[model samples]
Each structure stands twice: as structure tokens, then as C-alpha cells.
Target: MTLDQFEARAREFLESRCSRRGPVATEWGSGEERLALFHETTDEQERAEAEAALAWQRERWAAGFGWITGPVEHGGAGLSAEHDRRYREIEAEFDVPDMAPLRIGLGTVSHALLAAGTPEQIATHAVPLHRGEAVACQLFSEPEAGSDLAGVRTRGVRDGDTWRVDGQKVWTSNATFADIGLALIRTDPDAPKHRGLSMFLVPMNTPGIEVRPLRQMTGGASFCEVFLSDVRLDDALRLGEPGSGWKVATSALAGERRAVGDRSHEMNARAMALLATLAQRTGRADDPAVRDAWVSLHSRLQIARFQQQRMQATDERTLTGAERAIDKVLLAANYKLIGDLAAELLGPAFVADTGEWGTFNWNRWLMGSMGYRIAGGTEEILKTMLAERVLGLPREPQEMKR
Candidate 1:
């Protein structure tokens, strides 16, 4: 269908299902921004949000709007990415449940599965994930292997038709409630570090797998430290050919970076609005320094948005690893810029947790913004990749083995 037709249908569907809401109004100190870094919610609140998101997703999927870009066999509409983008634009007009929690599953994990998983694996996981029937998390980072994903020490040994996995994964987002995890494991210690890794689709409920929530400074326990001890997995759960995990991982990481970058524009808009409100409230709207900061941030945010558009225009199937790193770097930098501006605007109120509604509560966004710098890929690592691969710079010398 044409864009107009699709948008009209989407509008009709959304209006029929949910009430339309106006653009968020500025509430000065009484209202919080929509771009939340960490949600400090009770278990009941979290569960209710999750349930609402799932129900909304199911309804959208039943209407053939859930996974617009997914294959028809996988319960999607088999539409173009532009169609998906338009649907999201139309969706923004309604007051729907928050669906941010589904990003890791629907964007990162699902993309990885489509790239490297077998037909059965895709059919089993991707469809449910798209329908919001199942949630998935990435179990890639470890205590010793943050940016250096190839150095992961999680081990998996094959035993006939099963693989026994044992190791610990830190900074595992959404693991506390995930139904499955796409884990990277070391299967060949004798080989090179990057060559010995493999990926697995492990059921989170499998025996010997434990998840412990890690509280963050943002007052949220959204991340977790996962321990897998003698976790037995059938060989059918393997994601790709043995020892070919780096390929699968790089694909997923690229998707993660793209996803992070994709939302940078929206995030920047919200942050800019919040900053403007703060300046007005503090009577600093006329300050030259504040104006300069706001202008600089707006320019940088536009750059980030342009970068996202460029990345999207490129065929993801053909995007090189280095090219994909650009979005991540831009996103992290934009987030840091927003946090810094907020700090400047709020001054002392930025650091302390006053009982005020929007003033001190911004600490969550600042802390979370700092974490984004290190989340998908660290700034230093991504810059290194860009310099070496994209800029024709000489590679950093590898340390000689003792």
C-alpha cells in the first residue's frame, strides 16, 4: 500500500483502539520528561506495564502492524522498513502503553536471530518475540569482557547432543524477566580468543541458570548479573555453526548500535524541551551562556539525527561493521551532551535528590546518559574501530604474547 493509505489505516486503527493525546505539555516543575533513563517503579507497577505492553503488542500483531518489516511466515506483514517507520509516526499520536522494554527482544535479539538462526529457531523465537509472547535478552558482556566481547570467558562444552554452559554474565539488561537469552560462550579454548566463541539460544528457565538484579545509581534494577552453572542445552539451541559466533555477535551488536542511534533524535527533542522548561523556570532563559548551550545541543542533536537517517538509508544487509559503529558513537555523545546541559541548567539541584518533581528527578537521566557511553560500545573502542577501518589509519599494535 501507499504511505498515505497505510498511515490512514494505522490512524483509524489506533483511534478505534486508544484515545488520541496531544503533544506533551510543559508542566514546569510538576511534570517529568517522557524520556526516562531508569524507572523507579514497584513490582506491581512494572508487571502492569509489561502486561499492558504485551497486550498492546498482541493487538497490533493481530492487526498485522506488529512486525511490519518481518517476513510473512513469521507473523509479520512483510512490509518495507518505510512502512514500519510510518506506522510508528502514526502510533505517536495515541496514548499507548510504553513499549521500550521490548527493544532488546524485538530489535536486537530478533535481528540477530534473523541473521544467523536456523529456520526453526527463527520460527520459534522471532514470531513470539514479535507478538510479545516472549521476551529475550542478550547475555554477551562479562565482568572481564565489556568492550572486548571476544574475551568472554563463559565456557560451553559439547556432550553428544547437549552443551553444558558455565560462567557469569554481567550487565545483562532485562534478564530478570526475560524468557530466553542469546548468549555468547567460549567453546574452543585451544583456538584464538575470537575464533573459539559460539552463540546459543538458551531458555532462561533452564536449570542452573540464576539471575541476580544489580541495582544502578539511577534507582533502578533493570540490569542483572547472570550465573550459568552446568546449564544443559540441547544442540538444537545453537544459533550458528560452531566457532562462528563472532559473526553472529557482530551482527547483533550492529543492530544494537543502530537501535540506540535510531531513538537519539526523539531523546534529544525531549531533553531539549525539558531544558527549555528548566531555563524558563529558573529565569535563565535570557542568559547568553544558556542560549549558547541550547543552540550547540540542538545542532549536535540534528547531526545525530542526520547520521541516523544516513544509516537507515543504507542497506543494513550490506553495512560494514565500522560504518555501523558511527551511530553508536553519535548517540553516546549526544546523550552526554544532554546530560551536561541539564547539569549546567540545574546546577546544585542536578546532584541532590530534592523532593521536587522534575528538578532533582533528572539525576536519573544524567546517570543513565553516562551509562550509555559504555553500553553498546565504549567511545574509545568505537573510535578506534572508526579510525582503523573507516579512516585508513594504522592499526594499534597487538601486545606480544609472553
Candidate 2:
């Protein structure tokens, strides 16, 4: 289809389903403060949200808007990347499903499948994920390996005709209701750490797999710890050849780094808007100190938004390591700055039991902001990566073995 034809089709579909959000001005200290970086929802709430997201995605898939850039064989539109970009721009103006529920499935898992999954695997798994028949979550981080992803200890012992997976995965989002997990497990303990690993599209409902929600300081369980014990999965579920997982894993991680930053722009904007309103409501808007900090945080957020946009505008194939790391670091920095400014504006309101509109509500945000610094990729790890990979600095000395 021509560019104009695709744009027309998307606009027509969105107009029928949802109204346009032309200019939404925030009411001072009112409306849903919804300033959460990590969402906390009960099991029931999560199921409802996931269902809504899935229904919308399925509708879109039926309408030919789902998986706009994915290949036809994998149930995508088989269109150019530019077409996918255009579809997003058109969809942004309209009110639609939250889309958060399917983010990993489509953005990271599906992309990894395209890179490493066999054609049959893509048809059976990735296609359905985009079709909203299933939801997928990343099960890469483990208790022992968060930043050092290769140090994972999740083991998948080969048995005749199947593999038995046994290990624990921590900090997994959407594991509670996800249909599948793109899990990385060690298949060869004797090989070098990175070379021993393999990736799998593990069915979450397997008999021996368990997902336990983790309560965070924010008083909500936004993530989960998953345990697999003797859970047997078909060999067909393997994402790539044994020992090729490192390559497959990097493809997924790179997609994740790019999408995380791009997706955070709106959340940060809502937070900054709330911060500005809090200053006004508390009569600190005129204070020069508050004003300076607010402007600084706003400036930082704006720069981060631009960085995210620029990164998004660039072809994924061309993004350098430095380019991808910048947005994540900037985003974390802004989260911290936003929290600090909110605290300054909120005085005793920070911990007050009395429910003030914009006051105590920021408590949740503050907690998430601090935790986010270490989530995704830690600022420390991303910095070291930039130093060594992009700037050609000498590597950090590895500790000598005992």
C-alpha cells in the first residue's frame, strides 16, 4: 500500500473506535495523579487490564494494524519500517488500549523470535502474541544475574524428546498472567558462562512452574519471582540452537533498551506536570529554589524526551551502544530529580497520614524512582559499557580468581 493509503486506513479505523486526545491540559492537583513508574495492581485488576489490552490488540490485528512491521510469514503486515512508524504516529492522537500488557510480547519477544526463531516457532508463538491470543514476559534476570545477564544459573537439562527446566527468575513483569516467557537458562554448566546458556519460549502454565508476586516498597506487587522445577518443555520451544542464546539474547536486550526509553516519555511528562502543579498548590511555585529545581528537572526531562525520539527515529540497525544507553541513563536521572523536587515541595506532606491531593500521593512515585535507578540496566553498568565499548577506554580489571 502507498503511504497515504496506509495513513488513511489507520485514521479511519481509530476514529471509529476512539476519540482523539487533541490537547489534554492537567487540572491543578486533580485528576488521576497516575504518576507511577512501576504499576501496582491486584490480581483481579491485572487480569482486567490485561484482558482489555488483549481485546484491543486482537481487534487491531483483525483490522490489519497489529504487527505493522512484522513479516507476512510471521503474521505481520510485511511492510517497511517507515510504514510501522507512520501507523504509530497516527495511533498516538487517538485514545486506545493501554498497550503496556503486550509491550514485551511484541517489542522484545517477537523481535527475538524474528531473529532466531524457526519459521514454525514464529507462526505458532510470535504470531499469536501479536494477535493478542497470548502475552509474553522477559524471564532473563535471575537472583544471581541481574546486570551480568550471562551469569544466570537457571538450568535446562536435556532429556529425551524434551528439556527439564529448574531455576528461579526474579523481577519478571507480567509473569502472573502471561501465556509464555522468553526464558534464558543454562544448558551446559561445564562450558564458559556465556556459551553455556540457551533461550526458551517456556509455557508459563507448565506443571512445575510457579509465579509468586513480590511486594515492593510502594505497597504494590508490580513484579514477580518465578520458579521452575522439573518443568518439562518440548524441544521445539527452544528459541535458537544450543549455545546461540547469547546472540539471540542480545537482540532482545537491544530492542528492550530502545523501547523502554521511548515508552517512558509520556510517564515522565505526566510526572513533571504533576510536580509543577504540586508546587503551585503548596504555594512554593514562587520560591526561587523550587522554581530553579523545577526548571532543571523539566529541562532534563525534555532533553531525555528528545534523546528518546532521536533514538526512535534512527533505524534500529544503526543505533550504537552509546546511543541506546544515553536515553536509559537520562530517564533514570530525571526520575531521581523529579522525586527530589517533589520532596522539596511536599514538606511534611511527604509522610503525613492525612490524605492530601498532591502531597502524600508522591510517596509511591518517590519509592519507584529510587528503585528504577537500578532496574532495567543499572546506571553504573550502562556507563561502564559506554566507557569501554564506545570510548575505547581500558576495561575494568577483572578480579583475580582465588
The clash count for each model shown is 0, 0
Residue 367 lDDT (model 2)? 81
Q: Give the TM-score of candidate 2.
A: 0.95
Model 1 / residue 107 / CA error / Å: 0.4
Give per-residue CA lDDT, model 2, range 1-402, as digits (tens).
998999999999999999898655566645776756787778789888899999999989999988888888666898877788788878889878788888889888998999899889999999998898999999999998988989999999999879999999999989999999999999999998889999999988989999999998878898999999999989999999998788888888777776777667667777777777777788988999988887787788878877777766777677655787887788788888888888888888787847666678778778888777777677888899988998899999998978
> Cα deviation of 223 in candidate 2 (Å)?
1.1
Error of 1 at 228 (Å): 0.3
lDDT of 1 by residue, 1-402 (tens): 788888888988898999987776655654545545656665556667777888899999888898988988877788777788778877877899988667788888998999998889999988898887987889999999998889999999999999999999999877777898999999999999989999999899999999998888766777789999999999999999999999999989887887676656655676788788888888899999989988887887787777777766666667787766887787777777787877788899987877766677677777787788889888888898899888999999999999
Candidate 2 C-alpha error for residue 224, in Å: 1.1
Output the TM-score of candidate 1: 0.94
